[model samples]
Target chain A: MNRQFLLNLRRGFLVTVCFFVLLGIAYPLAVTGIGQAFFSSQANGSLTKNGSTLIGQQWNGPKWFQGRPDADDPMATGGTNLGPRSKTLVKDVKEQIALLKKERITPTPDLVTTSGSGVDADIAPVDAYAQVNAVAKARGLSVAAVRHLVSTQIHPAQFGFLGSPYVDVLQLNEALRTLR
Target chain B: MGFTWTIVAMIVVLAIAWRFLGAYMVSVYEGRTRWLSYIERPIYKIAGIDPDAEQSWQRYGASLIIFSGVMLLVGYMLLRLQGHLPLNPQHLPDVGPALSWNTIVSFVTNTNWQSYSGETTMSYLSQMGTLALQNFLSAAVGIAVAVALIRGFARKNSKTIGNFWVDVIRTTLYILLPIAFIVAIIFIAQGAIQTLAGPAHIHDLLNGVRQTIPRGPVASQETIKQLGTNGGGFFNANGAMPFENPTGLTNFLSMALILCIPVSLTYVFGKMVGHIRQGAAVLAVMVIIFGSWLAIGAVAEHQANPAVAAAGLSHQPTGNMEGKEVRFGDTSSAFYNITSTQTSTGSVDSANDSYTPMGGFAAMTGMMLGEVSPGGVGSGLYTILLFAIITVFIGGLMVGRTPEYLGKKIQAREVKLAAFGVLVMPITVLILTAVAVSVHAGRAGPLNAGPHGFSEILYTFTSVTNNNGSAFAGLSSNTAFYNIIETVGLLLGRFAIMVPVLALAGGLAAKNVVPASLGTFRTDKPMFIGLLIGVIMVVGALTFFPAVSLGPIVEQLSHGKFF
Candidate 1:
């Protein structure tokens, strides 16, 4: 029994050391080598650049768009963690509505509601039409023209089949930048 | 197609390479053991010092703490030296002092909550020496704890548990290393780049300009990354970039690799505990939860918006393809989301922020539920055990008997520890979310409108507290305020749960293993399995139901066509 225990102990120790050396050390080294050789940009965080100025990676979304009204930092991707009845959220929504009206852009359902981090609200897509009218009236344009712009500019579905018709805030803002 | 084949080939080669590596270690160790014993035959070695001795909870805990502390210091120093380090062709900026502290703590804690992007911030030396080393050690720590727990169940009145250093080393070498090696080879063949120099060169057709892509040793990190379920990426783009994931097949394979060890460990649990049924029950619960989330995400992806349909765009029969890699399609992307969320591996091929509200809800809930559906390496098993303890406690309560789990009595102390382990994350998340929404720093981040924007804030807190590093990628988390709060959340989220778990293990170690009787609840039975699943869901529901209904459910009702 004593001999057996010793043997098992020695075996376990040897196995453990060898395993770490290979997997922990060698494995990572080997993989890093491959990543460096082939897919260089991605291997190095997919960083983008323009004349020596480093921009964000293409994979990460930019935060300068109209922004999700639910959370504070629109540039950082995450949820608000607030409930629908949250007074703070309601106040923010009102402010957002006022801001959208000021910008002369109609708000989509996705634009007004809380998502992911467990807050709910009672805004619907129909609200978009109301916002469009509000924007049109403010812009001195016809409601139909406002509606047409909103519908045309929103992000269409994947191959046309996934998600509600909505505008990507970033794209819209980019277009606005060009308009400016 | 080329990408897909390359990925598949990578998976196969990784598996084979790991297996061979394991075999080699086993042989090498066996030979070493023979020589050591031959030398020690005349002298009696204390069992405590003996590598062969069964592990005790005390020793295991001590070793784990010491080893982790050393690694933390080492990783911190590496970060400090990066600006001056060699192999830094880009002359990348040095890591700031505060951020360096945060990074060290994050990696050591296995949180991998990165404040800085990889390619832009870290040099090659920093990546390999600090970040990569921590990846190995942190994962090794998880494996060590798991082995200790398994040994607790396996042993009877043992004075010593396993050697923490030995377990960490062996697990990394035998399990993680071999697998990683094989996977790296396959990844290389499949189109994953492996090199020691600058990034790949690509010419832009639109601008007729040449760009130098950043480069590093990615295959090595990617292997343990997924295997250990530590989600920090070599590049800030994570798995989404073509190099990191590369193709549809590689995506699937990487996803599988991330989940494989955690999933298989259930079988290992059963093997260790001498009960396959018990393992199956745990696995079944995990599969059920995973499957439900996948189905929800897939359907949500498949159901394109009415506006898009009106505009003549349609999602393929497979599902929604927006914000997803076309190479992998909906099926694979949806699967990736579920797997990554379930295992606490945060790598993503699609933009999670772009997922439909309902799909987003499922992903958030997956993380919020403590991610115990076969969670992170070592961490997952320990957490599942916590669930098991709770399940048995509730079972005991139902039958008006004293709670017992795996032959040990589940006393108040154990229950408290388990509860603390489970509840801490939610409490931290809720508190932080409340503070963020109520305060200026927190409220200043959203880029969307109204409740959905609020959900983004809440999701950030949830993901951070749960130690699942994937973000909605829609929030602006680069500010000083976010950096501080998130680092705090990550630290507490990891240590708070870990401390309790280790304490519970020690508590279990002290209890005498009770003999089984017919009246004793058979943990392996179907009824017990149902009870376990129920306990998990109920705890989740009770804790998150109100918050969830308020977010996704309300948002969907308000915005969804059916509503």
Candidate 2:
């Protein structure tokens, strides 16, 4: 048993080192090489002209179509883990609604509530359409044209039955730049 | 409709893959995947292990513990020295003492309950080297141990189970790595990012404001993160983060990855034991419990969040949206979170803390059921088998002398070991929870007040004790007190249970098989499945019932109308 114990230690040390290199170093580097080689844009975070279409950003004014209300800070992507019974959550939602009331068009639930990742990149189509009037009013473009732009930017669920159909706010705002 | 389809899609995918994956895994463990054993041979040469060596249970357990201990130290030191390590583009500083200890234990045990956010805390090297490496090894550890236990049943009066070194290496090289590689690239193609670059600094072209979006080798880490049931996130938001999970398609695929190994492991269990029905019985128990929990989670999240409703909006038709993504909506988020918790993969697409009281209950209770409804890859099969042993013992009590399962007699020693294995989780949970809630430090952990606050404390202990890494997230768990307590829980949760399981495996493997008789309690039948489920549910609910009432249950009764 004593000799077996000693042998176990030796094997453990050598095996641990062998695996750390094989799995830790070699595997990730190999995957990264493939990612950079082929899916360069997506692998590099799908970085669009407006920043990565994956991360939500703060929009200061109506010149841009706003993302979710509490969408800010990518330093640590997190959510307001407020309970459904949390008064703090209620107060925050009410404040968000008040903020949305001041904007043009209708407000949706997703616009009023924060996303699981505080940096959500997408919002429902209705939420985007709600911001069309404000974007049009701020840019001095016709609301019809701004709505058309929002419509064009909408991405349906992949493969018809996968995810929710929505629009990426960053991509939409970048597209809105082309409108007269 | 989306909810119904999501369930159907998940069930269909798992049903298609579980059998083939199970058969393939059996081959990997049984050493039939020799085509690339050229790769395995060199690893054995380096590790000084013989490919043909088999171990008694003690030797196998000793090797397993020693390997984990050395790796624990190595991982701990890596995190401490991460600031000075290469590939640290963010140049993050060393992890503090408490968090480092907490994190090493968490990863090494495959619990992956992150006390710190990933994008902020981990360097690229640390993410790739220490944490992600543990993701592979720890999961392999689980599969290895599980295969050893299955050997306990498969062999008759066998002194030796399989070799620890060979089982782990083969499982990783043949099963985990090959599958993870494919999944990682697919994840990248589906928009889950995989790059060596640091957090990207890009300006919003529309607004001219700069934001530093976090980036890493996320796709690689993520594939195993779900596939191995490790649940450690590359970012704080975990699966919710777009770069980590990407689209809804990726979301569905992630759930499939999490379920495939664990779900298929039942078939492996069946195939190894020489009777397909025996394994199929286990699979049925898992399916029933998993399906029931899925229903609860989906239905609970489908209801309009009371707080969201009380806040009053003209258009509040969509179900609970707080702490959930636009793409996942409510039902899909609940589906992902439930799948995660049910299997000891605590990764979340939505925040558990933000769910309706009942939705939160479903996720939390899944872990309280000991995560055996198609649990973690290796852990779940062994855990359910322990319950099976206990069930046979009960049957033995009723039927006079014989209480054999698959011809293995349920002696006193076997019964005690099984009881010891099953009891440790609840005992750890109760003790730590008692410590946390009574102390000021534990009291400070919750982010909300009243019942919700109480739920956070209970959830922390429950999650840690079960080694299910998903948190209520509302818990401020990074404190020295929690850091220390959680470490204790993770160790006791994983190893304490693991040692007894290995011992039980040894005992069973050493025993002579008694001939099957009419008096024997059958494990392969629907009746045995029902008994096994009853034992798990009763034990879980009875143990945690008092504590649970203070949290989600009470909050639900109050209709989320309480403070």
Candidate 3:
């Protein structure tokens, strides 16, 4: 019984060692070599560049386009941590609304609503008609015109199944940039 | 347009390949042919560690502790040397001392709770020599523990479990390495970067601007990183970069690789234990849970927002493609969400923060459940075993017999140990998240506005404590306080469960194999499977339901009512 246990132990040990060296060391080396040979750019770190200066990767979203009011500092990329009900959020949203009016751009619902991160301090579209009217007047557009644009542009439910209609601020900004 | 179907087809093919190809490899390793003997001989000689030595569980446990401690020291030193390191042409700044220690402990534990950004803090040397090495070994440790557990079941009255060093080495070399290599080659072919040099040659785009693509040895680390379900990325953006996940195919493949080993190990467990059906039952439960999450994520992503519709944009019935790789599209993004969260692999092709509220909730819940849908390579399977034990015990109780799993009686000791292993993370995650939110340091990092903002903090804690390294990205987690708190989470999340799992293995090893009889309750039956699934759900619900209600559920309800 003792001999059998020892033999089994040896076998288990051998198998485990063999498995590790092959999987851990040799395998990683081989894969690294292969990756080096072919997918050199991506295998490195899919870094994006603008001339000699390195821009962020395309996959990482840029914070600048969503307006100056609640945009995160590019250096930090961190949130301000203000909840929707916080007085700070309300104050920031009002200031952003006033700033949008100064730009003469119609305040889209996305611009006024809070996004996933509370830092941008945007106002939600679900706010009453009065607020929409207030935002529209601030932006020098009629409430009806802003409403029509929002209604036309916002996304609806998926296959009519999930999620409510919402606008993406970045995309809206892209559209605004193209407007004559 | 057909990107979604292409992704689905790719996933199916990869799954099939892993099932068959992995089996063939294991069989080859197990065979005693003289020609194949040469392959493993050199590895045995170089390490100066005997491959054929037997070890008691105590020795195995000791080696695990010692090796992990050494790795932690090495990883910490590597981070400190980053600015002056050979591969750091970018001359990235050195990591802060406190954050470096936290990161080292995180990866050593295989919790991988990175408080520092990958692109900014780590040079190529740190990424390869330290972070990537830890990714491999930590995964090996997980596989080692799993093998020990299997031995406990397979042996009738074994005095020894297995050698920890040997298990770690073999698991890395034989299993993780080969798969990672092939996957890396494929990824490079799909435009993943692989280099030791700085920026590659510049190319002018149609817009008349120059774009110099940065290059590195990403494909190599990426392969094992995903395969091991070690979610640390070479870049801050993670797999979202075109270089890391250039095409839809690579996205699909990465997702498959993350899950492949964990899933195949189920078959391996069955083989080792001489009970294939038992493995299949566990696989079924995993598949069901994964499939449900995938469906929910897809539907939630696909649903066009009413606000977007109001703005006159075309609602693509396909899904919300915002902040997602257009090359991969929505279906693939949704699939990525499910796989990444389910497996504790944090690589992402899309911005999870951009996911819709309910969609984000599904991902968060997947992490909070401990990502045990075949969790991170080694740890995932063991956690599932904990579930299986709980499941089998309940099954036995229902049938009016003392519970037995794989010929070993499931006694109070086993139950208590397994339960402790399974419950530790949920407790730590929820409690820490509550404390963080209430404290000044924790509540200070929200980049977005609303309840979803709060969810980000909660999600970070959940991901860290569960060893599922993905973040909501909106939280500023690079602070000293977050670094310390999350590192503690990472430590407790890993060691707390691992020690208990090892103890359980020791307990099981001492037991005699019981014979199957007329009164023996078959664990493979649907009734038992249902019971097991119920136990998992009930335990999960009981542990995390209140936390969930406060974070995602409340946010979702508030969004629905207010919006």
Candidate 4:
């Protein structure tokens, strides 16, 4: 309202504009450019042959090795966030158990549980192993052969202890394509 | 054992970083180093700012407010115009009025709470121009205020703190930008997405479906989101998504980045106050509290999820894998989230709402402690100091001696300002929670039922008021009522305390150091550290015990205890 206030506003406006250009625009663009130059695959999205994603997708039927239960919308991905004592969590888990029962598969916790992001990329190695027999029987393949495929796809936690050992469903199922 | 190793590694890395970063900040604030003067000078000129000119605390506060206000306005404009903007590969529409108001206020205050799922909502231009931009500036603003407060202790009878413009500029250029750049590259190499392109569509025949996966300049924003303690994620899953945090090393690095400045500023405090021990005492207090909570949380999450157990699927060895990524496992997720919550870097690698009730309790309590266990970049340092002031006051009363800290006499004005600053967040959280629970709009927000439902609401208000930005991920909070009400909480939570803190800095700046007597309270000693921790806990417990009891505590009791 006064000259001092006016001066402050002017100064504030100019500085804000400066930062917007320098930090907001220039900095991110530079990072993007550098990322594209060096790590092009990662920067653009880690896609493999035939447009396979790094993450797992919804796999249904007894023949396909299913990933974890997932949300349909990847664009609006987030956790189910069911509390420890919620009726919703109880009901969902029960429904998942019944589905696994129909498929005649051993129920693994990861198989039943939804992820933080609806589109989780990997499942626990145990989760993968639980499906080996079910898929093997459904596909008329030897259980040993399907189990070996699952074994080959297991990615140990980085540095043996950094994260959890897991299998990428995309890689595992792709390996399954090679089996008799 | 690996989880234990993580604790040990964090200790060593943060200890090393604490000293170096602390010293670097000392140099940056003292104007002893002009590492990037080539660009800094031009920026100052462009903005009509005189770098050498000093500002009284009032002027400094006013400048900060005006600048933040301007940023909010511009950011809002960007969000509203996202559909019209250039980088809309997904072609997302513009944000609505109430959500935009909530969002800009959230970012401007350094809270980063998202009522909207980011990947579906924010365009590439909006991500870079608005969200990522604020991540740098708001964090820089935090560091500036913190350094200003450090100067309040460092200077003797000074009429001014430092130039707000110069401080903001130097922090962005010298501190945040370079680190963010280097780490952005590292994030990219570690598989974080960073491109101008839009979503990647994959036609995999697994389900005979076409998947449109979102991608953008994620690595660019992800680095600063952690480094600046701005935990706004590129994807809605935040740290959990493989594209955002693909490896264990990146997760460890993010944990380091989140704690980096908050931990170092204590050293800066010590160096500025001419007593290094003073900073160590504060750091020791932070470590004790942070470590305990991390252990409790890790142990709690290591147990099988009861929901998993109920489904007869608890045979799997990885404890509580529900709503958690396989890469991080349950224990590692607990570690990352505890670090995130403690530092006010609220990025999540797992669904916090699905944690064993105690695990959620641990995360919630960290924010409830005013996030002073080495909190968000700048806010952490000052809030802890507020605790120290109160500790000294209470300690002085117990001994019947006049209180002094860093040679400055503690009086009524300083005490009142400190008390007001300390109480602002909790009081606002309580009031907002009460209002939200009573109304249908608030009650309908939580996705879960019973006590957990109550927690979703409590956690939302607490996260907003504290400016910690992490949510329970269970609240349907995009409604107009929450948007408008939370904007009020965000503003009051941020500015209300900040004004008083600056006033205190001015008051402290005016005081002359009184020579220490035998009876003078020794704030740099072990006793002070113990009392400081005591003060923080007592304050937190007294304020939030009833509210928490209704949420996590009651949920825990209803389910029976793991311990």
Candidate 5:
């Protein structure tokens, strides 16, 4: 009985080791290699550089369109769970609205609402459009020119239905920089 | 509005998948998928696993433990060595020893309780290679064990259950692979990122600040993570992250994937035991409990945070929007939170810690109910079966007769095994929670104190020991102390219960089926289902009530009254 148990144990151990090498080491390496070979852009973090600076730019400058109000930590990703009834949430939104009004831009609801992931890369169409004038004026550009550009940047709701239509804020901002 | 539609769509998709997937699995386990033998034939040959050669329960149990032990060591080594490996575009360091120990045991035990954030701590190689590989293997292991238990009930006067290796291989090839592959493709199509890319460095010309956007092979990892009920996310924000979930379609799809196999396994159980009604009965009980918790979470979350109310914000229209993704909305987030916890998938779309005190309670209690409200893939069915046996034993004692389940007499040995399997989780969770609170290290972790603090500590032990993997998010669990204690919780909670369950299968397989008489209890009847649920609830409630009282229960009462 002991011998049979031992034999099964040994075989089990051997199979585990073999499968580990096959799956744990070989499989992911192959997938990673293939991903890099074919989709190098995506496989390497989809990095798009403007001069030397990375995105996630502070939008305090009027030339930039803000994405969402995320926490200060770059690595951290999650929303402020301050409920609708939260005085803190109300205060934050109130402060944001006052600031946006000071810049002479109408703040959209999406601008004030915290995103599910704090570091949301996209903003609502209304939010983006609201900032067009501010951005155009900052760069001494025509509103029509900036509006056309923003419209081009809007990625339609995924497959046209999954999520709301929005534009990538960094990409839009990058486009603004290149505009004459 | 999107939340309501998503819920309806999710129900419709699950209802369809349950019938087809359930029926498909019946054939897969019955060895009827010969069309795939071309692939599996070489695999069986290399592994030296004879598909037809069944082993007795002792050998089967030994085989499982040995394989898990070996894989556990392999997983540990891989995590430790990931810093030197390729595909680490971020140059993330090797995992610290204690964290590595915690992580390996978490994944190996099928718990996937992540103390560290995936995007920061792990290389792409660690995520896809060791963690994702175990997601498939651990889930397959669970299904294999579950099938063995069913075989025990199906056969008469037989010492053998089934071949563990054959069961594991076939489950992976036939059930998990096809579903995960299709879902992974769908995720990619829906904009969930599949990349080998390093973290993105996009220049925001306006802000003058550099922000590094993390990227990874998210969609591929996500599919199996949910499908296998292994809840560890490639990103720390988990399914809530845009790169991971992306849209409502992916969200609905993920919840469905988390539920599909476990729900279908009920049909597999019924078909194997020659009674489809029995499977339906069990599934009904699971759905009832799960739906109740989901509803409770939604209502509680929508009621507004009282502390927020006292602070003077009123006229809220979207309900409690705090700590939730606006894209998913409050109702959907609440549903997802409850669904994830109840199913033991542990992948959260919303932070559970930020939930209203009662909302958090609803999620935690789902795990405390032994997570059998259609639990994680195989664990759900087997745990419920254990409950069924206890129910029968109780029913027998009340009526003065030897209890029987699926024709096998419910002898003392079987009853003891069932009791052990059911009681082990609660005991571990309670004891561990006690130890954690008593020690300075344990009390030191929670971000908040008072009852809410207690809830965080209690939730960790319950989540880890149950192999559920979701966290309250308020606990600072990355320390050496948490890593070690939670490692113990995951290992003991998984293997300790599994050992007795296999023994129970062996014991049942050896017994002859007794012919049904007037005194025999009908387990498939509605009355029996109620009794089984009653037994499950009573046991769960009685065992963990004190902990609940100390945590969410008191926290809820203390809300507005004190806070």
Candidate 6:
């Protein structure tokens, strides 16, 4: 029994190390290397840079369209797990509505409700259009031009069947920068 | 709305996969599949294992333990040395020791209960190399154990069950790999990212601030994450992240992959035992429980938050959408949350913590019910079979006859082994949860106050104990205290129950078959299926009722609901 146990242990160790080399090291590296060769932009973080530093831009001012509310920590990401009935959520929504009213823009449901990921990169087309007048005013552009820009930024549902239509906030903001 | 249609679409897809995948699995296990012999031969030769040679349950169990132990060691080494590894473009540091232990045990046991954020903590090397690799092996191990148990029932007075090495190899090479590769391709096509590039620096042109967007080979990891029932996410946001699951189709596919093997293995069980209805009976029980939980969760999630109703703001027609993806909406997200927990695949496409109190209960209770509503990949099959054995034992006692399941007589030893397997999880979860709540470190973990806070701690232990990896996501569980305790919970949760399960297989394998007669209880019938369901429900409720009551139940009640 002892002899068999030792032999089994030896076999186990050897096989595990061997399998690890095949699976843990070689396989992942090969796939990733192949991926890099074929899909460089995605593999390298779909980045469109301005200047040098990585961007953590929050679009609070009227010059750019706002995305989903982000978590407090810039590096961190999560949803606001506020129950619909919670006073905190209601207060926040009411405050958002009041602010939108001040800007003479009606708040869309998407604008006030936090997304599953607080770092949502897109907003519904309606939400995007709601901010057009303010963005037009801030950028010294015509409302028709800003609306046209929003129309250009609108992305159809993924593959035409998966999600609703939306505009990518980053892409929209990039267009805003180009306008300037 | 799209919510109801998504659920209908899911059922149709699952039903198709069930018939095809189930039949295919039967062929794979029976060695009737001809496509993979060449690859299988080389593997057996290199491992020095005789594919045809059967192993006594003792040797089989020992092999499983030793294999897992060695893999755990290899994984730990890779994680600790990840900083120096080649694929780490982010140059992340080595993991802390306790978290390392926790992670290694988590994946090795098929728990995959990630306490750390994947993008921040794991490099591409650790994510692909260590975590994803274990996803396949650990799931293979689970199926191997389950297959051994089925073999125990099939063989008549046999000295051996089956070869563990052969089972594991065939499961990975033929079953998991081909499917994962194909699914990975589909995911990539659907915009799920697959790349090796470092985190990209993006300048937010609007705010003039710089943001670094983290990216990696996510599609490849995502496939196995769902397919292997290993729920460790490529990102901390898990399947909810657009990168991990890009669209509605991916969401549907992810849910299907999580459940495919587990559901099909029931058919494999029937084919092995020479009775297809036996598989149907188990399948029915799984569907009934799973369907009921999904229904309750959907209804609860679809209702307006009572507090939201009280707030008197105009609410959207769609039900509570607070923490759910806009693409999937309420019903689909609720269904996914319940399914993930029930199957022991912890990947959440929605924030389960933000679910209504009743919806959260439905999710928690699924885990608390031992996750055998088509449980984790292979673990579900064996665990549920154990319950069936007990059910037969009970039926026998009531009718004044000897208990027989699939023609194998249930003896005193079989009963004890099954009971031990069933009882260990609750004991471990309850005891650990009590200890956690009493300690200062544990108290500091929950982010919420009141019963919801209690649910966070409770959900953590329950998820770990059942080897179900989903969490409430409201707990700060990254500290050394949680890591150590959760590790202990995961290890015991896996091997404590696993060891006895193998022992039961051995016991069953040694028993002489008694042919079914009119006096013999028919386990493949609807009545038997009902009885089996009752046994499972009673055991789950009895074992977990108090703790659950203290957590989700009271939380829901406090919110003014009876159920």
Candidate-wise lDDT, in order: 0.61, 0.88, 0.65, 0.86, 0.79, 0.79
* Chain B, per-candidate TM-score: 0.88, 0.98, 0.93, 0.98, 0.98, 0.97
Q: Write the per-residue lDDT of candidate 5 for residues B136-164, one digit (tens) a residue.
A: 88999998999999999998899899888
List the candidates ranked by DockQ, beginning with the highest.
Answer: 2, 4, 6, 5, 3, 1
Candidate 3 residue spans exceeding 4 A from truth:
A1-180, B1-11, B14-18, B21-43, B200-214, B305-318, B560-563
Pitting candidate 3 against candidate 6, the one with the higher TM-score is: 6
Worst 10 residues of 1 chain B by lDDT: B39-48
DockQ of 5: 0.28
Best by DockQ: 2
| Two-way TM-score contest, 3 vs 5, winner | 5
Question: Is candidate 2 or 6 superior in lDDT?
Answer: 2
Of candidate 5 chain A, the 10-residue stretch with the lowest lDDT total is A49-58
- Tens-digit per-residue lDDT, A12-87, candidate 6: 7766655567666665555556556666544444456542111123676777787655552224555665543345
- Kept native contacts, fraction for each prediction: 0.08, 0.83, 0.15, 0.75, 0.26, 0.34
Off by over 4 Å in 6: A33-57, A72-75, A80-101, A129-166, A171-180, B305-314, B559-563
Tens digits of per-residue lDDT for model 6, B1-563: 45556667767877787788888887888888869777678666776777788899999999999899988888899888888887888889999899999999999999899798888899988888789889989999999999999988888888898888888888887888888877776676556777776666665444766666677888878888899898988887787777777667788889889989889898888888888888988999999999899999989988765544443435655567666666566776787788899998898887887787899889999988887999999899889988988999999999988889888888899999999899988999999999999999999997666677888899999999988888888698999999999988899989998899999888888888887888988887889989999999999999889888887777776653211
Clashing pairs in 4: none
Error of 6 at B34 (Å): 4.9
Candidate 2 stretches greater than 4 Å from native:
B560-562
* Candidate 4 chain A lDDT trough over 10 residues, lowest sum: A49-58
3 against 4, candidate with superior TM-score: 4
TM-score against truth, every candidate: 0.72, 0.98, 0.78, 0.98, 0.89, 0.92
TM-score-wise, the better of 4 and 6 is: 4
User: Compared to the true structure, candidate 5 yields what TM-score?
Assistant: 0.89
RMSD of each: 10.8, 1.4, 8.3, 1.8, 3.8, 3.2
Off by over 4 Å in 1: A1-180, B1-50, B53-55, B204-207, B305-319, B560-563
